[model samples]
Target: MDDITIDRVLKSKDLLNLTDEELISLVEQYVPSQGCSGAAYGYLQIVSHICYFREHLQSKLMKIAIRPIIYLGINDHKEVLGFITGEYLIEKTYKPATEFGRDWIIGKLQLNETLLKDIFEEIVIEENIRF
Candidate 1:
């Protein structure tokens, strides 16, 4: 894979390892520059989607290994821009052969759900978090 792919893989792995508190600290550490905030928003958006989707589907969360949290940039009109792919992992042990739900998987990999929700709102508004 190329540098971008590798970057994503490492980022995902890095993200997956964070504790809920660490994840919040990670977000708090950044959020000033346009680029950083944009990427942060993108990450939260994907997580939110996964959570909402899993909730709506009532799907039992998964613990799949070697899963990739793939993303693509889309405009307000739903036009595709570019793709952002990352490797997401589950640190907790799981059953031998069952596929896990996105919520359960991403849940362990994230710091906190509330933080992600706020970040997502900022992204939706294209604004920085207040306080």
Candidate 2:
């Protein structure tokens, strides 16, 4: 996905108002091919924005939109989890349902527990968050 596309999606006020077809089309266009880290950052930005802005959409719709991007290799999945972790822990912007949705995405991605633990620990340390 290009920066322009990413920016457009992020700036949109009516994200959740999009039809399922529109959302799926955006996901299809935004998800990069495997091993395409060059576009991964932009893709991540878009996905994070979707997660934040469209949290009220059905879980099935979110799964449909996000499932394809999970195939972009383990590293990319880790990045997504890491970003979501930051949003949850540091930003604290997620509502309960949004947090559950993000956790569901993480579960679907099947990332390693150790990697997730490490990511959480690293973020806590970086942000100096107390237990």
Candidate 3:
């Protein structure tokens, strides 16, 4: 909620609506947090955590959405497959690979596969799309 929190988090501020248990599950696989300082840094860290968690959630959804396509070209066209994935990510999440940073995006996937899939299903249905 602080001004310094990443804009991506601000863009989808609904992240705060998730329960603490859901938030904890989403962040369980992330790399350690980076150094930050300031009176508002604590607030910013919480916001950043939510943003990172949701980004991973988006990635999980995208991987499932594109799994069939990815499998088809995983061996012969890995780079092209990456490109397609990036494009789909931008289309669905509105965040480009460049903006999100490939290292951050690829690191620390969600560990709760079944839970994540269920949550994604609940939110992605026709009536729930929030764009």
What lDDT does the true structure give each of the candidates?
A: 0.30, 0.45, 0.37
For residues 14-130, write the lDDT of model 1, one tens digit per residue: 435444444334333423224532443334333333333334321111111101111122322111101111222222222111222344334443434443344334344553323
Per-candidate RMSD, Å: 13.2, 12.0, 13.4
Ranking by TM-score: 2, 3, 1
lDDT of 3 by residue, 1-115 (tens): 2232234443555556665545444334322223211211222233233535556454443433332333333322333234343443345433233333333334532233454
Tens-digit lDDT string for candidate 2 (22-128): 76567656544444333433444455456555544434333433333343433343554554445332453312123433554455423445544454455445646
Q: In each prediction, how many residue pairs overlap at the backbone (N, C-alpha, C within less than 3 A)?
A: 5, 0, 0
| Pairs that clash in candidate 2 | none
Residue 99 Cα positional deviation in candidate 2, in Å, after optimal superposition? 15
Candidate 3 steric clashes? 0
Question: Cα deviation of 2 in candidate 1 (Å)?
Answer: 24
* Candidate 1: residue pairs that collide: 20-111, 61-101, 62-100, 62-101, 63-100
Judged by whole-model lDDT over C-alpha atoms, candidate 2 comes out at 0.45
By summed lDDT, which 10 consecutive residues of candidate 1 come out lowest? 61-70
Better of 1 and 2 by TM-score: 2
